[model samples]
Target: MMATTHALAGVALAVLVGVLFPESAAGTSLLPVAAAALGGLFPDFDLYAGHRRTLHFPVYFSVAAAVAVAVAVAVPTVTTVAAALFLVAAGLHSAMDALGGGLELKPWLGTSDRAVYSHYHRRWIRPRRWIRYDGAPEDLLAAGAFALPALYVLDGTARTVVLGALGISAGYVLLRKPMVEVTQAVVDALPDEHLDRLPARFVEDFR
Candidate 1:
């Protein structure tokens, strides 16, 4: 899914957590929501390195999040709640990747088998293609689904952020395929030396 989608999912999770524990910091402040959103975006930071494998620890994150949640529930504070939500959001992002398309220049083509890496399993998980690909029309829908409740519940800066995310998601859906084509064109024109310095995925299919 798009980073915005993942972040929105995290926001939705935070909203749920707030609803379930109205007395918790998650309900009282935007800090937990911010933490969750950042966590959702954290795994994707490995995009330039190992992509899904570098930081996308589906199993390990889930385990750590389980423990973190227990700790937070035992003593809920801004720090504890934020930390727990962060881990949970990161874990959710990692696991959710399995339900999307694979790590490919054109994931909508469904050509790659690798969706996410599971270090615990010592292997890659196959793509489920539940949403076709990041920035797919369906992906926008998913983002919207996750955003609606958040928009309804959040106010001030958090609400603005969600609106901004929705706009970005829409623009990305329109440009996703075209961006790949543009990347391919640039890759094709670049010298081999320059191409060699670029990320492998940028030139793998084009080369």
Candidate 2:
């Protein structure tokens, strides 16, 4: 999925998990909660690169956790679990992004990139390495953006789960069509010379 969608999902998931298992949630400290949210954005650091977004390997997650723990020790505000969850959320979001397809997730072992979020590998190590950034499907992005907040509100109950599901459905139905219509309008509004520059995918995919 796109970084935005993954970030939205990660935030909502953390909130939902925090709410559902309030007592057992890893992040007891507010610092950790914030850290987790930040950590969730960790994998996407690749956006700084010239290429698209992709998942870092397990090593990246481990390094992130260790760095977070060390930082927590100095800060003395967050706990081990809190920092760990931050890394885990980032890793999870990276993993889920693969489900959207158009790319493969491979483990980036060795000192390939950097320390924490160095590099990524393909789901398969083929004769020819083919790894690309996998953005979220348009409908999935729209559905996820809405569903995540709904899930957070639902907070993991059966009723809330139902509501979240409905919200996802509604988003898929509404956003996709409206986005297309809006794109058409924009295209029509733009000068003929600028038509080539305005890709419809931008309107549909970019929320």
Candidate 3:
């Protein structure tokens, strides 16, 4: 998986849940969906500071939920519902990371100097799994970061949206990764001195 994948997966799941569950839908408001999309990847802010663990934890999530609830109460419509929707999206993101077969997110904030890694998300028929990092489990929720917006206009049944979005996103990711891989391959062909100047996250040194 990749960052783009995680985001799309999360959006696909949230919209599907909201539309089908109706119970999750915050009425006509798109606020919750927006919040959820934002919250879904809120955890990834951690990557920027290299200390963004809190953006992903239950405690932080609780705070976000409170804010969402407050907005729901204040606006009391699709706006308020947006808050609830956000909670669902963020919650889903966290839960997925927790149960992943190959990945173990920084479960609790302030517990590690570095994020832990495993294959926890790779399980079969897993339950309530979070769609953490779409790119790789070690990463944050990057895929869903993009997927959420694309799915916003997704029309039709929940199942249909998921199927459609999944197909589109998976293809997008596969296409992107190989280009990166090829670019990296070219970089790998370069002499060590030439590669030394490239940034780590840059495609030139995509290891």
Of the candidates shown, which would achieve the greatest TM-score relative to the real structure? Answer: 1
Show the lowest summed lDDT stretch of 10 residues, model 2. Answer: 103-112
Each model's total of backbone clashes: 0, 7, 38
Every candidate's lDDT: 0.93, 0.48, 0.48
Question: How would the candidate models be sorted by lDDT, starting from the highest?
Answer: 1, 3, 2
Considering summed lDDT, which 10 consecutive residues are worst modelled in model 1? 196-205
lDDT of 1 by residue, 114-172 (tens): 99999999999999999999999999999999999899999888899999999999999
For all the candidates, what are their Cα RMSDs to the real structure?
0.8, 9.5, 8.9
Model 2 TM-score, 2 decimals: 0.44
Q: Candidate 2: lDDT of 102?
A: 36
Give the winner by TM-score: 1 or 2. Answer: 1
Q: What would the per-residue lDDT of candidate 2 be over residues 1-207, giving only the tens digit for each residue?
A: 444454455456555655655554433434444455566566767653422244455446666766865664556433665666677667765555443333212222221232222254533222111222222245344446635553544433633543554455445444544555676676667676775565443433332
